[model samples]
Target: MSRKVIVTCALTGAGDTTSRSEHVPVSPAQIAADAIAAARAGASVVHIHVRDIATGQGSRDVALYREVVRQVKESDVDPVINLTAGMGGDLFIDPSNPTVHLPGTDLVSGLERLAHVEELRPEICTIDCGSLNFGEGSQLYISTPDMLREGAARIRELGVKPEMEIFDTGNLWFANVMVEEGLIAPPPLYQLCMGIPYGAPADPGLLKVMVNMLPQGAEWTSFGIGRNQLPWVEHSVRLGGHVRVGLEDNLYLSKGVKATNAQLTERAISIVESMGHTVATPDEAREILKLDKVASA
Candidate 1:
């Protein structure tokens, strides 16, 4: 049995989740408030993704990221702030032109994606390990080996812990390669993203297979989308891993009953405690993740 399980709340994802649930935080104020509440409710880490409030579309503007980080730090929230470096990797191809990227393709260099982590120095940030065919369309989430190497190196130099985001088995293998290449810090962190259509399925058998591939001495968490989110709270624990929950990956406590990010965290904490496991606080979580000591941000 796992002694201590850390809960990470993914506040607001960059997907089209804003309209799916009115409870999803849009403005920076709302996002910060939700994060603080989730921390108070027992989440030790908060993964964040900013949006254009007017249009609810994902954005990579540093100004928006700066405000979000500032608000979270200024507030009483002590959860580890994890900004998304996975933004700028979305590649919507143009079949018409074949060679040219479409309007939706938000292709940016690895350095450009880490601007927020470099400037704000969040305790943790995601370094998406590999690219894959996303959903049923022509959309592809491209994170090539070269980009992953550069992103991991930049994050390492900034003294930020990179939570290697692995969408599939291949991604996990490549993360190990980065570790060997001296691109990442020691004892690399991983987040096993399950059930995103084109990626690995949200099955216990598959999750175990992915978990088995984790490098020795790696810290990891696994999460499944939609209905699988709640089940993963227990699955990850039993598999010697941590847990993550929030509106970013799921919205309802029950169908037709929307849930706030704090509610989701509370529920996950309850499950952890029920299983004879204790949850870690932000400070404690930092130590477990081997993150830099909190600065006076």
Candidate 2:
């Protein structure tokens, strides 16, 4: 059966990719502009992560998030805004002294992480379901059961859909527990994040297992980082799921070729169309995800 895929553009992740690619947006205006461009290029949703304007690193500043959301809402194209509530969970431990928190650590309460989400009230926000080793460094992403519960409850209360981000099988398992515990409502939305270090490897077998583990009738999408970004688009579509692409997962359109968010969205659209599948509009995506219509500003 043919399907209409919802293409989500994850603009500028919190990673340190600014130096690697000039296309990564750092300021709120740049991020909003890129999101609008991606929307015009056929993206139904825009996953956002604000950066420190001065340092070009990730930030949890509520004002920065406010400005980005404001600009996106004021734009002509109305893609579903998905803000990242995954910040404030980084736990950088001191290598020599494990008990000593390092400089990169930015741990905070779950409520503090959702401050922007509460104030902005975007249609969608992400909740990283569980903790992981994160990456090659001594850094660890901390999302305990209590933290997930608090985040999920608050997101539910705000009437915003929680896009559960599953980094590994354990995260997926706890996400199911969140649903069973009645924190998340029906028609859950999930983003199967593959190819990250120390988590689920970006493999077809792993994707198949993760996809099967999703709640019945759930709306899901999958992505792979770096070289696997484009390939995973085809994999997701073939596996009866949606697709995500942007500078967040990859910096290059091809080897030695930098790519903008709009360029990535266009590429994803081309792939979907080539497979005899239509790309869903923002309104169509809202319908498919069962999200209430967000009024235009």
The Cα local distance difference test for each model comes to: 0.87, 0.93
lDDT of 2: 0.93
RMSD of each: 2.0, 2.0
Across residues 1-297, which tens digit of lDDT does each residue of candidate 2 receive?
Answer: 778899999999999999999999999999999999999999999999999999999999999999998999998999999999999999999889999998989999988999999899988999999999988879999999999998899888888899999999999999999988988866888999999998899998899999999888898999999999998999999999999999999998998899999999999999999999999999999899888732221
| Model 2 poorest ten-residue lDDT run | 288-297
Q: Give the TM-score of candidate 2.
A: 0.97
Clashing pairs in 1: none
> Please, what are the lDDT tens digits per residue for candidate 1 over residues 167-226?
889999999889888777766789999998798999899999988887789899999898
TM-scores, all models, native as reference: 0.96, 0.97
Error of 1 at 266 (Å): 0.5
Candidate 1 has what TM-score?
Answer: 0.96
